[model samples]
Structures are given as structure tokens and as C-alpha cells.
Target: MPRTTGIRALIRPLRQALRRRISRWITRCCGTPHPRTGPLPAPGRILVCQSNSRLGNTLLLIPLLQGLADRYPHARIDVVIKGCVHGSLLQSLPGIGHVHELPARGAAPRAMLKLIRELRRLHYDLAVEANSLSTTNRILLAGCGASHRLGFAGPDQCLRLTHAVALPSVASHSALQLLHLLTALPGRAPASQPTLAVYPDAPTRARAETRLRRALGSIPANRPVIGFFTRATGNKQLPNAWWQQWRAALHAGGDPPLLIEIVPPGGLPVHADQAAVSTTDLMELAALLARLDVFVSADCGPMHLAAAAGIPVVGLFRATPASRFAPLGNDCISLDEPLHPVVVARETVWRYDRRRDTRRSA
Candidate 1:
């Protein structure tokens, strides 16, 4: 097993290098030649690359998308996302006019060729590598041949693009780092709040509610819905079990209030009085989160999704520091492990009350 593991590890770096090279070559081939004598042209069409695998990881790109939308409000924002995340993920964002799905989960050469052809046809004006600073994602963005290719400069980063942002120190959130790609542009500020537009239609809302009800029988709408996501065996796990406990206690302390959504190891089970939505699809998860009043999840993608949907997110952070990955919203709440239960309950109540007041004000 160790030998196989070592081989697998070795293969990844090698595969990444090859993918990065292919990405660089594709970008160079697709690049448009404009004279260096003038300033960059205004964005006519922009491609935001978010081909990352994990759902939570891709959600990190929301800030970049929002920032771009804010700066070039009129620019058509196109996202190049993996098929699993495309439909459910980018559809809700404010500026995302189109999402070009990259069919690359399986079948390498054919998929790569198809993606390259599709990009060639689009001929985007600017390409922002809003994904990870890894060699692969950077190279993929570089290959898009946008007039302005933006990414970070790592020590051995080979995918040479014209515009680049310096990688933030380890202390910065990965979401914030993705926004650095925007800093390379003029008249753009990185301080803008991250926004994700989740406008679920009546039909979608009904379907989601129906599914939740079917799974968790008869939940009271009057009760505050506290979501617990503990499937963190992999990348999806959050370390806020203690917070969930505190939330349960707080609810017990409340009057007729506290329905928890339990998503666990064997998948979401059928239960009464709560909603359970279990899917690997990032977009569906985001939509479900939009319906939630508050979500308590690990420091993973769903936490950000819940936060982006404007729901209050109580993100429990573990080995990965909460400082870097806290949900990016006023309503989003985060708690560190080993924290006092009173603090957790107080913060949850405060945010919940604040959300209620905001709705009342609105």
C-alpha cells in the first residue's frame, strides 16, 4: 500500500506538469495579438476559470465573480467550470451570463481537445485564473488566450501569463487570494464584499422544500433551522461539532424553536421535523442552502455556499485555520473548536436576531 501510495503521489506531480504544459501551449495558440503600444482594452467578454474539483473549493471563486461584476457591471461573465459544478454553481451568481462546462472528469485527450476547441471559439477578451494557484489551474487559465491572462506567480510556476498577482501569505483565505487576480486590473478594489446571487424560482423552491420534507417529515417553519454537516471524512468535513451541540442546547433553551438538518456518514436519512439535502452537486447544495435560515458546517465548500446564499453560516474550523476560510458575509457566523459553548450560543443568537432584523427592515 505504501509503495502504491508513493507511486500515486509521484504520478500526480507528473500529471500536473503535463497538464500545465498543455494548458500553456493552448493559451499561447489561442492568444490574440494586440499592440503593446496602448492600454488594455475594456473587457468585452471575460472568462473566469473555476475548474477545481471540490464543491466548497469552487465556491471560493464567488468573490472573484462578484468583484468582476462590480467593476465591469456590463461585461458578460463566462465561467469555465467542471460539469458537476457548472449548472448548479454559476447559475446563481449575479454577473455569470454563461457557464461553459468542462467535460473532463474522465477521458483525457478527447476532453482536453473539446475544451480547447470550445474556448478557441469563444475568443474571450480577458481570462482570470480564479481557481487555485496550483500549476495545473494556472496553466489552464493561461491556455484560454484571453487578452489579459491573470494568475499568481509561484516559484516554479511555468504557465507564463502577462498579468499576475503575488500569492498572499499563508494567513489569507483562499477565497481572498482568488480575488487577487482582480487586483492586477486597474480601477478595481479587492475590499468589495463577496456576493453570490441565489434567486431560486417558485418551482425550484417548492421542489427543494418537498424533497426536504420527504426526508425529514414534519419540520416546523416557525422553528429556527440549524443545519449540521459532519461528513468531513474528506474535504467536506467541518470541525464545529461542539457548536452544533451548543446550537442544540440553545434551541432547547428557546420556545418552540430548533429544527436541525442532519447530514451524516450514511447520507441524509429520512426523519421528521427537519430537511435533509444530500448531493455531490455544488449548485443544488447552494440552492438548498439559500432556503436555510442558518447553516452550521465544517470549514468546507458548503459553508461558503451557505454564506454566499446570504444565510447565516456557523463554520466550525479544524486543522485548517478559521481565519483563512471563514464565511464572507455579515450573516455568516464562524466558531473555532475548544471554544466555550456560551460564546457559540451567544454568537448564533446574535446573528440569528440580526438576520431577523435585517429581514424586518427590508
Candidate 2:
């Protein structure tokens, strides 16, 4: 397992040295990037480098995208995303012009070089390094060759973050940190309320609902459907027995909510007393999640996706800290075990007004 803190500390000096080298090379390759010194004009073309390859990271970036769309309503935003599957993740998001799908981190040298050439072919008014703690992200920000570059300043990262904002004094989630980076611009302020968001179009919603109805058999007017995602990465994965225990407790509370398995990536439909739905299409999954009354899962991408879909979520936090990646929005809460299942059931039923928990009291 990668101990992130230890790795980051070990690589810090190497990162600094590489930054200096890249700084000099960028000046020669793309010419000197202009400093953000004068009255700012609205940028027409913007590039953001946040190539961290995780479904959760991709979803968490929505707030920053929301901020850019709001602040520069007319500008075009491009995201350089790593990983093959994630390239299309944000392609359809409003105000996004393009998604530059870079190969996964540590791709072939030729592919990386080709991507650099392609990026250098265009001119961007602004570029952003959206991560606070990534040497690769910073190097890509420099390579983008935008007229003005922005980032969160870490110790001695002046070469890349010519226009940088100091990280917030108080600790915050990674999503919030990215949003704060936008505030460094002149006459700019971060969104008052930042939430992860995904917009599923009408056809997509219709298709999702159709599939859901097939599984649900009958859509009752007064029932609460609770979603459960059974798998997570590494130690975050919860065993089937644990879920059985939770559900049993809920049943003991009487009028148990309908439990549906919301399968995660690389997971099969759980063979249990529940309906299961799985799809490769994220938006379709989001739409299906949206129709549900509430969602429950270990801290994972689908948990974030459910929050983006505007559903109430109960996120399980055992291996990961909920402080950074907990579902943010209305009626969302993060909990650590050993969660008293009876208490959880009671609270969920009460909050959702699940008097014997029906399919959403119409």
C-alpha cells in the first residue's frame, strides 16, 4: 500500500529540483510566460491540469468546474485528464469545451511527448494546476504554456505558480482547496456553496428510469428506496456479512427500507435479498442513483456520484477520512463503525419520513 504522506515527503526535494529544471526548459520551449500583473480581462481559453487518476477525484473536481463556469461564463474550459475511462467523465458538463485525455500517469515516453506537442500547438489565456500537492500536475501546468498560470503555492514552487494563492489556514477538503485556487484571480471569489455536481440529460434520465422500473417491478407511491454499494478499494471494502448485519438491524427496527445494491466498478451484482443494478455509463448510474430516496456506501466514487445526483447519502468511513471526501450536500452524513445499525435505521427512517419506509410518500 502506498503511504502517501511518506512518499510525498521523500519526493519533495526531487520535485523542487525537477521544477527548477522544467522552469528553465519551459522558458526556452514556450518562451517566457507573462506574469499576471495588469488589469485582467476575461479569459477565452483556459486549461486545467488535474490528472490524478481516480473516479473520486474526477467527481470531486465538479466544484471547481462549477466555479469556473460561473465566474467566466463565456470562457472555454478544457480539462487534461489522465486515465482512459475518465476522459469522458466531464466531457458533457456545461461550459466545458473539451476533455484532453492524457494516457494514465507513467505512460509511454512517445505518447507523453506527443501530448506535449499537441498542447503547445494551442495558445491559452490561462492555465491552472488544480492540485496542491503534485509535481506532475505542476509540470503539466508549466508545459501548457498559457499566458497566465495559477496554482496553490507550496514551499519553493514559485517557478510554476507565478500567480499562486496560499492554502487556507484551516484544513479543508481537496474539492474546496481546488475552488480556493480560483479565488486568487483578481476580482474573483469562490462559489458561496460548492457541491459536486453532474447533469444527466433527459434521454439519459428516461433510459435510467426504464431500467430501474424493470428491476423495481412496481413503483409504489409511498416507499423509501435505500441504495447500498458493497465494494470499495483495498481496506475500504466492506464484507457481505457486515452488510447483512446492518440490514438485519434495520429489519429489526420494523418497516425496513427497500435495499438495492448499487454496484461499484469491478463489482458484480451482490447475491442477496436485494435488487441489483450495474452499468458502465456513469451518467446512467447517476440518474439511477438520483431516483432513489437515499444512498449508502463506503467512501467511494459512487458515493460522491450519489451526492452529485442530489440524493441523500449516508457514507461509511472506515479506511478513509470523511473530512476530505465525505458526501457534501443536503441530508448527507458520514459515519464510522461500529455503527449501531438500529440507531442508523431509526435516524434514516425518521429523516426521510420513512414511516415503515415506502417508495417516497407521494
Please name the candidate that would achieve the greatest lDDT relative to the true structure.
2
- Considering only N, C-alpha and C atoms within 3 Å, which residue pairs clash in candidate 1? 27-143, 56-301, 88-283, 216-271, 219-273, 232-237, 238-298
Which lDDT tens digits does candidate 2 get at residues 1-362?
77567788889889988877775566455432433333457999888888787889988888888788788899999988776566555876778988887766567878867777777777888888876566567667767778888876544353444466777654477788788877678766787567877788899999999988887778776667788887888888778777777777767755666778877556666665578877888889989999988888889988898998888888888888787788977778888877666666655666566423343343
Give the range of the ten consecutive residues with the poorest summed lDDT in model 1.
Answer: 30-39
Residue 219 local lDDT, model 2 = 75
Give model 1's TM-score versus the native structure.
Answer: 0.78
In order, what is each prediction's RMSD in angstroms?
5.2, 4.7
Query: Clashes in model 2: which pairs?
Result: 222-358, 222-359, 223-358, 223-359, 223-360, 224-358, 224-359
What's the TM-score of every candidate structure? 0.78, 0.85
lDDT of 1 by residue, 254-302 (tens): 4634445556435653333344556554445566677666776667666
The lDDT, on a scale of 0 to 1, for candidate 2 is: 0.76
Error of 1 at 25 (Å): 17
